[model samples]
Target: MEHNHDNIKLTSAEVSYLWNTYLGDSLSICVFKYFLEHVEDKEIKTITTHALDLSQQHIETIQSIFLNEGIQIPQGFTEQDVNLKSKRLFTDVFYLKYIKNMTKGGLATYGRLLQNIYRHDIRSFFSKCLTSTIELDTEVVRLLLEKGIAACPPTIPYPQKIEFVHKQSFFLEGLGRRDALTGAEVANLHSNIETNQLGTSLAIAFSQVAQSNKVRKFILRGNDIASKHIKVFSSYLEMNSLPVPMSFDQEVTESTESPFSDKLMLFHFGLMIYAGIGNYGVAISESRKSDLVVDYTRLTAEILKLSEDFANIIVANEWLEQPPLSANRKDLTKG
Candidate 1:
């Protein structure tokens, strides 16, 4: 392998980000292996097993990079961070949705890393990882759709026929300035990683026994979403030459049984989706290029739909949160 020996040096920030990603990937595969043990669906198990293998390979590659650079790699979290014995606590549905969101985050994060790496070998390595991550995300989505766990993006109803008004307008001319000024929005992107970690871990714990094919696919899709977001946010810090915040400060509690009530779980997910939307919105607004906005916009929409569907499930189960307003409007009207 060709290595860059020029003036190029790995900063602590860069190393930290890479280290976090390494840990994340390692944990992901380990969790998948646990999922593999209880999944009854052969096809889903096969795909997960393959994904786990790829994640293992990725960890080795990253370790090698750190070793070659004489940089001491930090020992990140592993399956030990998860309580494997707590596997009977939740429904498979909850677990799968969690995984899909996480994977989505990983994909975005890795893709951003590929964009900023300068060294030839470094760039090549990240490129390979980025491509693999995207492939896995696509596969996860496909599996979700096949199993009917994937939520379709909402579409506006269209009229059968419409009149055309061919007029030129500068609608977007000043709107970009007005809407793009979320520059002061202090979004803790690292918070996203932490939330995703907790969510995915919980999902993996339940997925061990929840062998529903639909649930497995949902978990995988969630994993992709989480992965992509991690990479995306990491890029912003890298661009500023700032540190990648890896606050695994929070303790992980394993619950195979769903500790959260169904309504609470749905609400929690709704909060995460909105959080993701805000983060991506900031990224899109702050970005100077079109492609960046386009990417964030696409992911934001996906997450939004996932959240809505999860909410739907909650409602069907009669586990929905009580509305802030009265179930009846009579009380408000009378007051």
Candidate 2:
């Protein structure tokens, strides 16, 4: 049935995007606010300020949209969720790396959101978000380069001529010897290693400061998972004699005081788990080696199980905010 354009309502996809975006930005605001409080480097502080401003603006924009649609606004993270005065949990260099990783994730998210949105306004909003994230990513890269901390991907010698694979052995698992890694494979390995490094570092910090014993144990388990994944990815690089990316575990401080509420910390950890699954999915698609694919597939399954457990924790704690849902005709009939 054709419906009037003026009467069009928000679709489930659009509502889901908005709900997730709101939660992400709310968490970002709290994180950046805490970073701004203790950041010592002038350059890092400036970027941190810009990031916090963007998150706050996003929250306001999303709130206005929710109000207009008569949808109840999600009680996302708030001041009570963050203790800005708590001791610094990470170094300035960590902040730089965090923002850079966040920008990369934002680009991926907004790109997917743009593809899902049908309403003109929703599409336009996501387009703007994508553009802003691109700019932010550029700035972070420039700063990282200037500071000499950016790990540029390994450079390969220029090819003299075009070449093609001659046999199925090219894709076969090597028992004694293997073919050299392709640029795409190398890139995926490096990117996944870096992502897992960041996740491990964050988990370390969260584990130290988490108040609830259950939450602390869960966070520590996450740290162990991230560490194991890093090793798995790094082994591939090592077999090829490629340098592995260094872990950011040393960047975490010794402070045991909680910087964020247990609820926010749990949500933040959950978000990282979701992002990890997406990263692994992309890596598996880009990878061609049979062993590599098997490894990622297994690791992804393990993380999925952990994520399910994390969801149960959130629900038990009554911290899982419900997303917009379609009306139930069966319930309506009973009423």
Candidate 3:
């Protein structure tokens, strides 16, 4: 229970961000509990239990840090914000997808914080967070496989050249088909699934949380893109009888304004898009003789482009958080 306030400098915004994350962790505990009790799948239930335990531990750790600093705790969303008793309109598969997506958000947030914060105590907390979130992500994938819902994208051999949309006509006029299968195609499909999940979650969250007409319209476009990708992936998954990740849960509201700031919403979108491109790229490199890689590559390109557009919106709204860098004139640098 040692308090070390002397070493680290924290801004109000940083403090607020930590507090929000803490609250989110707390809420996730409750959300996971709901899933554990309601979900019929045993593997998913175990994953939820493990995630809940980690989130509970994180909440305690953050609370202890706040207490040490003598900072008043800010209230977070409560059961009041969630309608637990509401009838189940969406499948547990969608709930699991949402859980997976939320962990990605947590990973991005804490990973960035770990790189930026100078304080030993705070950095240590974020380090734990990053590790825990990664574990949760693994568990999620495990559950997906156990439930027979995991999508297996086809792979391709390396000797055969794979054609990508970008490499082809700018308007997607000509595409070639390969005969042999390769492992890289599976990687690409896996990556597409990950990114598609993120986009789907963002659309659902925005439909439920946003209050602005303009913002909702933007979110709607995002939803369209995500839905289209999900359909394509679902078709592939269905061929193997792999449970398709749920698309457009009725639980999410289709609204104009949101509870979160436009900046936060767009920032979250940007991070997911960034991750999406890398995930797809990995698949492209690992895919075999399958055409799935080509499809996902096209989707990745689209997501990257859309992500850049969203980034511009974030910048225009002054929502982008500037990273730490050295001044051109080092002598003038001051703490």
Best by TM-score: 2
- Top lDDT prediction, candidate number: 2
The candidate, 2 or 3, that scores higher on lDDT is 2
Please rank every candidate by TM-score, starting with the best. 2, 3, 1
* Tens-digit lDDT string for candidate 2 (1-335): 44344567888998889888998999999999999999999988988898888888888888988898888889999999999889989999999999998998999899877887998767777788888888888989999999999976776668999999776666776633354777888988898889888988988898889999999889889888988988998898888888888777899999999999999998988988999999899988887687888899999998998899899999999999888888989999994
Provide the lDDT at 249 for model 2. 80
Q: What lDDT does candidate 2 reach at residue 190?
A: 90
What lDDT would candidate 1 get against the real structure? 0.56
- Please provide, for model 3 over 23-98, each residue's C-alpha lDDT reduced to its tens digit, 9 standing for 90 to 100: 5675676566655645766666677788889888978887887887776664543454344453332456766776
Which of the two, 1 or 2, has more lDDT?
Answer: 2
Per-candidate count of clashing residue pairs (backbone under 3 Å): 47, 0, 29
- Rank order by lDDT, top first? 2, 3, 1
RMSD over all Cα atoms, model 3:
7.8
TM-score of each: 0.50, 0.95, 0.56
Stretches > 4 Å off in candidate 3:
1-7, 11-20, 23-30, 33-37, 70-72, 104-112, 158-190, 201-219, 228-335
What is the alpha-carbon lDDT for the whole of candidate 2?
Answer: 0.88
Clashes of 1: 47
